[model samples]
Target: MNAQSPKTVDDTRLDSVIYQDGIMRISYTLTKTSKDEIDSDAFTKDKKALAASVSCDEKGLGQFVKSGLLIKYTINDSSSAPITDFQIGKSDCL
Candidate 1:
């Protein structure tokens, strides 16, 4: 039997995002922006910034962020392959 790798998302200026063993964990910071302000347009406009701010890939993470799920108080960790299709959401930084 093979063991799967743990999924993870880094803390942002406003919140922390993590996925471990299929469970998604999202915690907000004191500076966390209001959820009401986080809309599709805002997410779309800030995709790059959001991706950069977090520890996830711009493209993969963009999918979830664009979906407005990131703003939620709770979210389910996707089974999708990390950094592949709708997955972990981590990107390589130079």
Candidate 2:
């Protein structure tokens, strides 16, 4: 599924990058920006800062780099029991 889904709009928030020795760890975060509906025009202006870490080991070392978008949206329906979609873009970084 595309990360641009309505439900994935929150999972693209702040993420964590962990480096262990020559190994690298990565994570992604989804957050709710506001309860208000997002505007198509404003949403198109979304952008995120890509970051990563690598080791200088002589042997093959692990590297971690992430580049993606952070989405924000609200639950417009209270009676729907919350419809959430977790299937978003592939993790091709690993």
Residues 21-94, model 1: lDDT tens digits: 54455433323244443453455445535434563445555445444333323221222112111222223232
What are the candidates' C-alpha RMSDs? 12.1, 12.4
List TM-scores for all candidates, in order: 0.24, 0.22
Q: Any idea what lDDT model 1 has?
A: 0.36
What TM-score does candidate 2 reach?
A: 0.22
**C-alpha lDDT of all candidate models, in order:** 0.36, 0.29
- Which 10-residue window of candidate 1 scores lowest in summed lDDT? 76-85
The residue ranges of model 2 lying beyond 4 angstroms of the native Cα positions read: 1-11, 32-94
Task: Report the lDDT tens digits of candidate 2 across residue range 1-94.
Answer: 1243333333453233444543333333335433244453344233211121122122323221223322222222233222231211114233
Model 1, residue 28: distance off in Å is 3.1
